[model samples]
Target: MCGIIGIYGNPEAARMAALGMFAEQHRGQESCGLAVSDGKVIHLYKSMGLVKEVFTDEVLKTLPGYIAVGHVRYPTKGAATKFNTQPHLVETLFGPSYALASNGDLVNYDQIRARLEAENVYFNSDNDGELLVKYLAWQIIAKNKDVVEAIRCLMKDIKGAYSCVFCTRKELYMFRDPLSIRPMIWGKNINGDVVVASESCVLDILDVNGRSEVPAAGIIEVNADGVKVIGNNPAQYRQQNHHSYCVFEHIYFSRPDSYHFGENVFEVREDIGRKLAEQDKGLEADCVVPVPDSANFMAVGYSAASGIPLSLGLIRNHYIGRTFIKPEQTIRDESVRQKFNVLPNFFKGKKVVLVDDSIVRGTTIRKIVRMIKLAGAEEIHLRIGSPAICYSCYYGIDTPHREELAANRYSLEEIKERIGVNSLKYLDMNSLRECLKEPDEYCYACFDGKYPLEKE
Candidate 1:
């Protein structure tokens, strides 16, 4: 998953995009970039680092424009290098005419890229965002298709999740895949400048008005005239009759304060916790201790439902990024050690109920359980807020291989033994669905192995 932002009609478009990207820094940490158009040329700058470190005030000053597109990348399709970082820009005979940044993984990337290559189109990077821009540029420049029509063709041809922000020298366009697997919301800020982002929190930070999801297979264009919404019929592109948003967004990916997929993220997490508590009817514990940050709300609901006092027994180092999103296992293991610490004398002689969003590799949770154990906790009854991830996610998340997931490899009892917990339980699939308003509209392929769009 990644974060994308677009700003139009704002003189400080680059600065505003930087703030929005900073708000969404949690979505990605590997690298970030921005493309700003001053109505003449699109200036592009990107680097492999945190948003705050890369887009400093001095760096933002170099980019002046009334239109901007920005991205924060968590690598899923390509190697973790500068070459794969987005917002990918394409220049033509008329100079830099298009820059595109997207949040999603393409299943038919190789097939489409080969088709383009067969037509004599070249590529600079293996990143899917680059392929998207090149595809549109090919259609607009070579086949002479309108920009909106080119996006429609893309929706029908590409098979996967993509919430995109595409900008030209004079206009900005936002679009999403047919299933709406990833979140993309847009509205006008108080300044009346049009803004689009991967999450509502970015729109909140910018004080946007009338914010709404960029519709499924829908395209919104912002230019000198005004904003125009192209509400495309998604059924034309896919066989699925319902939207397939990623359920993990509510469980782990999104910030609790951010709202998307027609539900409040934090509320859904709390509901998950309550559902988890409902599953443990007879269990007793001294305190409910949650893995900090993401699982904070779940613990709140769990404590409330189970009548257990919530304890902040673990302290997290905010300086370290999310361990789950780290590209390599070695890096993730190291991050788990550096990211969390036990509170002084908090867990001593206590029967603790530990809460976490979900277990992917099981490495991070094992270390955390070990830390609490060494701190003198008498028992740790681990509760997962979502169902066991038995399959890999292809749309946007980094669970690329089934063997890499703990649940896919081990039985429930085996996972409990491996994590060194007294008891382990995950929120069942039906219980998890109860936490959402429109559960059927979401994707649980990571848990159920029912892929909405097969890889081409």
Candidate 2:
């Protein structure tokens, strides 16, 4: 997954995009970039680092423009390198130059790239973002189509999740895949400047008003004329069975404070914990302890439902970036040691109910459980807020291989034994659906292997 933002008609467009990227740093940490259009030229800057490290005040000053697009990349489809960093710029020989940044993965990327390569189109990076821009550029420059027609063609040809933002010399364009698997929202600031982001939290950060989602299978344009829906062809863009919005957004990917799919993430997570408590009705524990950060709200709900007090058994070091987003397994393992620490005397001789978002590889949680046991805790009962992730995600998330996922490789009892936990319970799939406002609208492919798009 990645974070993308576009700012239009703002004097400090680049600066505003920087702030929005900072707010969404949690979504990605491997690299960050921004492209600004001054109505004449598109200036680009990108680097492999955190948002704050990449976009300093001096750097922002260099990107002078009235419209800008930014991206924080997590490397779902390519290696973590400067070449893979986004806000990918494409210079068209016959049409206006444009930059594109997207938040989802394409399952048919290899086929598309091969077709483009056969047409003599060269590639700079292995990333899907570059392929997407090249495809759009091909339609615009080679096929003599406008931006709207190019996007419509993209919607028809691309087969995966993509919530994208594109910026030209004069306009900003945003569109989501037929399923709307990833989140995208648009609003207007007090000055009537249009803002679009992967999440509503950025709109709140910018004090934008009338925050509204870009329609599923929709294309929108923002310019001096204001925000307008260019197209909304749900019938042509719709997936087979349902909308297939990514459920992981509510369970873990999104910020608890953010709202997506007409439901508050924090509330849904809390309800998930309550449901887990209902499942484990006879569980015995001295205190409910969250794994920290993402699981804090779920632990809160578990505490309230189980009539147990909440305690900060694990203290997170917020200075470090999230370990899961780190590209290398070695870095992820090392960061886990530095990212969280056991609170002294908190779990001593106590039975602790450890609440965490979900277990993917199970490496980090295994280490965490070991730390808790070493801290003199009598027992560690692992409670996951989401259902077991038994399958890989094709729509933008980093879970690319089934073998890498612990749940996919082992049974529940085996998982508990492997993690060295006294007991382990994942929220049931039915319970997870019950917590959502529109249960049938989500894609539970990662949990249940029901992919919205056919495997490539």
Candidate number achieving the greatest TM-score relative to the actual structure: 1
Best by lDDT: 1
Question: After superposition on all CA atoms, how large is the RMSD of candidate 2?
Answer: 1.1
| Residue 405 lDDT, candidate 2, scale 0-100 | 95
Per-residue lDDT of candidate 2, residues 60-94 (tens digit): 99999999999999898989889999989997665
lDDT digits (tens) for residues 1-456 of candidate 1: 999999999999999999999999999999999999999989999999999999999999999999999999999999999999999999878444899999999999999999999999898889999999999999888888999999999998899999999998999999999999999999997789999999999999999978999999999998989999999999999897899999999888898889899999999999999999999998989999999889999999999999999999999999999999999999999998899999998999999999999999999999999999999999999999999999998898998889999998999999999999999999999999888998899899999999998877
* Cand. 1 TM to true fold: 0.99
Error of 1 at 73 (Å): 0.5
lDDT of 1 at 436: 91
Candidate RMSDs in order: 0.8, 1.1
lDDT of 1: 0.94
Candidate 2 residue pairs in clash (backbone atoms < 3 Å): none
